[model samples]
Target chain A: IDAVCTAHGLSVAEFHALRARATEAKTRAYCPYSNFRVGAALLARAGEGEGESGGRYVLGANVENASYPVTTCAERVALGTAVVEGLHSGNGRGFRAIAVSTDAEGPASPCGMCRQFIREFCELSMPILMFDKNDTFIVMTLGELLPLSFGPDNMGVKDPAKP
Target chain B: IDAVCTAHGLSVAEFHALRARATEAKTRAYCPYSNFRVGAALLARAGEGEGESGGRYVLGANVENASYPVTTCAERVALGTAVVEGLHSGNGRGFRAIAVSTDAEGPASPCGMCRQFIREFCELSMPILMFDKNDTFIVMTLGELLPLSFGPDNMGVKDPAKP
Candidate 1:
């Protein structure tokens, strides 16, 4: 736990708080069809505040379509929400961390598209924490999921260069 | 135009042609990473020793994954190719009759969880087609897309007859 906090430059208390939010969000998952509910929460850098919460974007499970093909995963829904919110905020800062929770037997991992979309939007070093029902977790970097990925560079789209 | 056939009741020529060769599948969609690409061929069905060709099964594209969360759009890719082949097969299965496509514009119209999966395995119906580049499509059936939709009554799990 300490190592995870240190790697992400997050204080111990702050990391715990993010995990709590993720757990709460998990209950909101709309998975009546698959019965595989998932939840995600995104934490942004401190200092940007408009509402009671500052620099934090929380996303709950939202299943949009009945046709399986049209269904969006919890992680993507959350990420999309965060991206839209972040863009509107105009801070130009990427997410600092993301926490995920699932009810699978072991740790439930995100699908391939979720990781790609997350990697595309965040920095290589962004911290991602995946927790199982038992509260045990596997913490890693977004880059670990997608090594040598095709990103903005391939598309020739300029990302706001990292400061 | 002579290879494919479809039928609401009469077995449209174009869709029927592709339904014969359901074996020896097409491209393997190795989507261990999120680079969704797939290619499929809707074969024309033929009678045993009769040399009758009018059945088809569409092939799929390759959808990749950088990580587990993001995966390829196999359903759309296969569906698209099927639609293209259906039109050219010209056995008389119209394009607009198809409901799903396996392409890249949006999420592939199929997922592992839906009833379409059951339709794919059962071989209950004929003239299966998928969509092409445009929102249009090829011919196909519920059995082609879904092998066994969760049948609540099959396992004696739910007795709708009594309730």
Candidate 2:
């Protein structure tokens, strides 16, 4: 935990908080259809003028619709809420790490859509922490999860993730 | 508005509000990638003990991700929020109508994924209202949008829409 946190610029508190809260968020999921529950917690990067030590956290659980495609995954709900709440991405300000918790035996990764969504506001180097129900976990950077990602730069639009 | 509202059991006020709100919701969309903005509103089934005439309205706009597939349609966002806020789908108590507004020349219907999500909560007869940028519109039932639907009943689960 110490080495991982240090390497990712996350504090021990942030790491633990993400895991615990993501687990807790799963209980709030309204998944009567697939009966699958997922929870996500996002750690924001520190704002300008502040050292890159402390940041805020946002949480979301999978919100499924009977229409499977309409379901918003845990990572997305967190990202949407963050965007609406004014967590801008650009100029080195954006999310630091994302922690996701699920009830599977193996660590559950973000789906394709979520990988795309995260690409909008997170850096290629942002760490994604996936935790299985047993607390066993694996981590990957955003670049590895979604290779050759398309973004604002692709469309010639100025975007935070580009820089 | 009056004719369609009467046919769908929606009052003129309700129908107009749905259109206006859905259109308004489109402005709040975070679609820097696709440059396409969409909005949706859902009318809840009336409360138990009350006739199936009036229910509350929930709104959501398309929240886009840099990844196109992860881009959530406006329809799903509304449904997810409804579920989180304690709306139940059964016993004539799910959504009665869904309205979508987009800035296209023709009416923009909910995507296939959204159709499936609606299936989880809506009755077959539920009407879907589509509005173009000019508010010129079309309407279809959930059944028509997605025929031969699959539901919780397929998995041997007792669900309201299934019965």
Candidate 3:
């Protein structure tokens, strides 16, 4: 936990809160198809005086459709909610970190589609925290997870919140 | 148009409206990445006393992410919105038909992921209407679009709305 806190600049409290909130969000998932519930929480970059845990956080749970392909993973749902709320366009940098919790025995990482989605709003160095049911976890930077990634910069598209 | 109307049990006006609405929704897309715009409209089944066009219609425009795979196709976006609106849990059938419009030369088909997503909420015979830039179109049933598809049934799962 100390290593994670140090590596990501998150206080121990912030890390614990992220885990609790992400686990809570997992319960709200609509996944009759997969019976696999995944929850995600994002820590948005905060303003000047806000302390480590003071940043705005948004939660998202997997919303599955009967058609499996239609399933919106926990990661994309969180990011989509962020975009709709105008968080992506905010100052102080876009996203600081994202954490995901799932009921799987082993840590489950973001899928290809979600990795792409993260590439949109997060810097390559942004950390993604994955937690399994047992609280065992693994962490990977966005850059390490998706090498040679394509981003909005590729198309000369700046921030999504900008016109 | 006449054949589509006759074959699909839709009146001429319904067909025209689906095409027009889908085309209009295309204008709302946020695709700075691919510059590939797609719009989709679903004709939900109305309750007994509803008018021909009275069934609620849901519109979706492709919302892109910097990561290409994270980019949701227009079809899934519309369907996801429907799920969030409590429309999927309605007494009437979830959706009767889906129409997609794009600026591509020939009609654009829904992607493989979208085809899988469509399989969940629609019946095998559900028709998918594809419209190109010139207002030209082609119609195919969901079963035809995705052959031997996998769905909730495959996983012993059921209604997306049901807990």
Q: After superposing the true interface residues, what Cα RMSD does each candidate give?
A: 7.4, 2.8, 3.5
lDDT of 2: 0.79
Please write out the lDDT profile of model 1 over residues B1-163, one tens digit for every residue. Answer: 2334424443454333322212112236564333343334434333234233434445554454333333334445555565455432233332222233343554244455423433322234543454444435444465565555555456566422121
- Candidate 3 lDDT at B51 equals 60
CA-lDDT, candidates in order = 0.56, 0.79, 0.78
- Order candidates by DockQ, high to low: 2, 3, 1
DockQ of 3: 0.26
* DockQ scores of the candidates: 0.09, 0.30, 0.26
Error of 1 at B112 (Å): 16
The DockQ-based CAPRI class assigned to model 2 is: acceptable
Candidate 1 local Cα displacement, residue A32, angstroms: 1.9
Q: Write the per-residue lDDT of candidate 3 for residues B52-110, one digit (tens) a residue.
A: 55587778778787655567877876775555444555556467788999999999999
What fraction of the real A-B contacts shows up in model 2? 0.38
- What DockQ does candidate 2 have relative to the true complex? 0.30
Docking quality of model 3: it rates as acceptable
Q: Number of clashing residue pairs in every model?
A: 93, 5, 2
Please, what is the TM-score per model?
Answer: 0.58, 0.75, 0.64
Cα miss at B127, model 3 (Å)? 1.2
